[model samples]
Target: MKYEISGKKRFSAFSLYTLSFLSGVVMGLTVAPVGAWFLAWIALAPLWILIIKNEKLKIKNSGEKSSFLIALAWGIGYHGVALSWITGIHPMNWLGVPWWPSLAITLFCWAFVSLWGGIFVAVWATVMARVAQQQPWLRVLIGTAVWCGLESLWSAGPLWWSSLAYTQSPHNLVILHLGQISGPNTVTAAIAAINGLIAEAWINRQYRNKYLAIASGIFITCHLIGLLLYSRPIAQPPAAALKVGIIQGNIPNKIKLLPEGLRRALTGYTNGYLTLVDQGVNAVLTPEGALPFFQRDLMRTSLASAVQQKGVVVWIGAFGERGRSYTNSLFNVTGNGEITSRYDKAKLVPLGEYIPFENILGGIVQRLSPLDEHQVPGLPNQIFDTPFGRAIVGICYESAFPDVFRRQAANGGQFILSSSNDAHYSAAMPLQHHAQDIMRAIETDRWTARATNTGYSAFVNPHGKTLWISGYNTYETHAEIIYRRQTQTLYVRWGDWLTPILLGLSALGWGVNIFWQNDGNTELRS
Candidate 1:
């Protein structure tokens, strides 16, 4: 004799919660560091099943509340489990706050930040639970839409991280080629659609569902196309080449601004630039905030010596003050010792670069801050003209956003130079940041040279392959044959084309659901 529980009755309330959270944890592991990309293909299957397998009796009275709560739990699980490395930073304690209070503040801040992604997951889950009342096939398309839409909006906002597609970056060469077709959203949508089919198949306990077969077929077809694309040669007779020198100074953020630290940074940057110039680089680029002060302070004898060496343009990251506000900027010293072609950072790190609601909440956070933090944003799409070609400058965190590069490339940028200061972050953060650039490179078909003030400085090709990679805690310089790409991708020409279509499909499904609800047809039949 055997006993088996069925549907929602199979698991207790606590057991369901654990299952929901586990789904999210699996999803989180799909991203960088862990990079279990295969898990992303099935991560949401359990969550989808959790929503669909519930009885109408349970959903009717409290489905909205239940769905919202479950999604929030999933968000907490994914973000809380994945980004727990945030606690390692202990940003408040970095400000000299007491250990106890710092711990409290750190947890609170992490939860607050996690809510950004959590809210999107919550919305997606809520809609899926409601849509579960409808056709199973419709659930597949709408569910995919919901996830793609959420990632689309989130990537545009201040708290942007790698998109779900980014999990496969720099590794999954086959699926990663999808970025060349429709940006990262294509891969993310494909994953979501597959999971949706898997969920429906599981709900009816039919492993041989045609929907599952179709989804599988699509996945395999896309991979095959990706393989064909990957096998092709990347260096298709480049129009021009720009040899850039990337300087990585292994300096900690804590001492980087101190007198001795500033001296060391200046010395390290100058030496690196001069060495690369002697080796015949067209230009030399340093990491963000490599020079703590303004342009005048950087006009020292060492800098002059760098300028005097040759016509090699020296691009230094400095603080540019205009009236009361200041910008984290990049500029060049010409052969005539003239400063020109300046690009300021527009996208800022929400808390690190500048505090939000500073006037109202500034008092409370001031005690936790090590120093006054204020940096003004610059105008968008500032492409600097160099002898090699036009270059786009994405300072620090801004490099993570694809549109930042797209806009610059559209404005006629040929090559990409990203300057970052990531010393304050933990071990996993640099790799995460690098993954973003790899996607950007694939999308725009541009060569990317990322110079950071500690680690993860590398040269990436248009095929999203790492040409050269470096380690942390070392002063080093890299010179590579960087190609200038004037070619525009479909993604560059039409930005986020999938997002609105996905959102529209979700809206149509939601509208239909609303009609069914008003007509008292909770059970959607075809």
Candidate 2:
């Protein structure tokens, strides 16, 4: 005969918290760059279980630090494990830095990035304990809303940068389709909703009963909506055939800064353009920072002359330095070798492009990539007039943000030109990178021609289908992208309206729960 312990122990609380965080990590690891997104549902089950157990034990009501500590510990564990892939770059001898130092830095970076999601979870757990009390549905709804609100408010949060939702990527076909309406924020909110549902089920101890039934209904509703949206086929614009060639000059990020390697890098790009010209391509697009050095009048050079002689337009990506500030710029070269139009990259990478607090982190910037004191942010949503058609240019991380592309489309951008270099970051980033391009395509209802330095070059149609894509393991030699244009999508017109409304509804729901004690008591049993 075994003696049974009647009370909830501190160890059990720790175990539950640990399990919640671990589930998040496992869920994150399953999505993108590695497309095992089916785990999103699986990961939420444990969190739901814990929430139910916590309510039954009245741990949320207990005047104890156990719950808080458990949540924090779980957050740390989840972020630490999920973002481990970022640390992969640390071991490599980048810029002659030693492995240990790189590893330490990488780990710290991952830790910082993971903290956003952890903080959201911790706060949600606390809020549900206080406001929702023992009401599971209200608890889940509040938790999801608060998390999504924070994600929107703090765009710089870990949830924004290195997010679990981003990992779901192109494989999360349903969410990717939803991205057309609300962008990635919708997918993120959906993940939070799923997690909250799981937590509520566990708290109520009705995990297999009403919980499954409700979750199935919600899932089916979302899936049906996504299917209907995708089923509405978009019509392509009937424009004259314009042959375009996208050059993916796989320039090594390390040697790009060296003075000696400048010639080689420039030659590589020139040769790629020449090949495209030889193939009788009407337009050629190059990857971002294809030119190591920048000249004020790049189009007047010999490189432009050869392309002009070929009677084709060439779009060159380079770092344009003006007075101490540098801008990621795209130059449009005419057949007569003239700089017809230029569009500077608007959305700059936080740390990679420009550090927020340069006064304090200027030294750190110098140590990392070869960026100067500051890389100036460009004007929001500038469209370049290409020879073949009107094109919106998304440079590097600029593609990830919907506003950038939305504004361009509104300004008469018929197609998209995305130039990125993922070599400086880990190779694994391209999977999500690819997904982002597709989402942008669906949002704008325009075809996208993405040319990356390392890999992930592709042509994505308005239907969120990849007409062309390259492998990620190694550098693709070159890509000559050609695609038809599509009309503007509804999502491009209304950028992220659903997410804000959901956030407002969530707040209202919680307000009702908190202010009206009578309703709260009635729902406590439900």
Candidate 3:
């Protein structure tokens, strides 16, 4: 087990960790809307290589403490940078809180979430090292297993989230179809195996190790198989056509709150709807909170001429309240000056949307809004009816969770819609956020329309392809964006089953290895 790194270590552990973390942050920008995940992949490989070499050296010197410290430090550094977008929350002018506390809360959440990635790396390093020392190929199996196992527990939906591997999907078009069969967990497993196999090669030049070759072959083969499988398009729905108009008014919060902001917001959507009406779209949609205030009665009556002229269905986002609780809501307004129905957003953002433990965090949440609990989490799942189709709506940021869209399709949503306000994060954030919709479309095999206040408003078909998108940093409108019904994917049908199987198989393999080793020793002694 000759394990020392070959060259003089250019940097101390802290410096290496910092470099790795910075790499992760910069690399993560490639995922999703950014579409630069391949760079992250290339950047991340060197970090693992460094870790493997350093750990091997420590093992040779019998430096047990350095091994864990090196591993943990790398884990912290990598995750801290990879998830830095989480800190965007700090600068928001919610309820009017000072920027510092807002940013502090967001940073704390990112720091908390970073622990999961850290734990995965910490345990994987220790286990991979022990196994690679003996059967070098086992590192590939164990690494993939551990990564998939952790991802399975998180699931890919609303309440729980998984993000690391998601960055890669947007960067490489190869995995566009990967989500159909095993979902992102498959990609995560493959990525881990690739990282592990490469690190194993760095540790030892055991060129003849059949197990390593076999493991690497199997890993690549599975991904290739996934690529082939994903080539087929989801079967289109046998349903009637629905006309829809999406308005990207690109409203700014600062301007939106001014004396004329509400009128501007209302006018933009009304004009967009009129354009759609002339274009013969059956339904018109607007981004989340296109209207600053909730005006159930006003929308029902005051806009009668426009509604009458369009003479169709309109779905829009606004503030809705019941008693003291207010909601960021979607409303179905009909042509005859009638309020058809309303669905409130569930799964509110932790600090930005609503405070979880109001008694403890109420003071903080209230500082940003007059109401402590601004929006209520609609009961588990709800779908709204529109002339265009049955739409499962998750307000902005809700699309990040896979399950929110999955269950909607399971329960009969023909298409998924996210009415979002990304104006807060600037144009770059929306472009990045659109990538999540691609995964959701794959997971559910449903078309998704993301209408944003600032930018990245786009349409994703069932196959995870973008049909149309708004220009960055601009107020815009997209019309006649056709929606489709897609055949269900394995992921949609079975939910998170693929991830659990990977975890279970790993446990079984590890247990069998232990038993087999014990038996072999006993036989030799006898």
Best by TM-score: 1
Backbone clashes in model 1, listed as residue pairs:
none
Q: For each candidate, C-alpha RMSD in Å?
A: 3.6, 4.2, 3.9
User: Any idea what lDDT model 1 has?
Assistant: 0.78
Worst 10 residues of 3 by lDDT: 153-162
Query: Candidate 1, residues 341-417: lDDT per residue as tens digits?
Result: 88989888776677789898778766666645467788875778866778877888887677888888888888788
Q: Summarize candidate 3's per-residue lDDT along 178-222 as a digit string, tens digits.
A: 666766776676666666665566656656365367546855686
Q: Which 10 residues in a row give candidate 1 its minimum summed lDDT?
A: 1-10
Whole-model lDDT values for every prediction: 0.78, 0.67, 0.66
Structural similarity to truth (TM-score) of each candidate = 0.91, 0.86, 0.85
> Against the hidden true structure, what lDDT does model 2 obtain?
0.67
lDDT of 2 at 453: 82
Clashes of each: 0, 7, 16
Mind sharing the TM-score for model 1?
Answer: 0.91
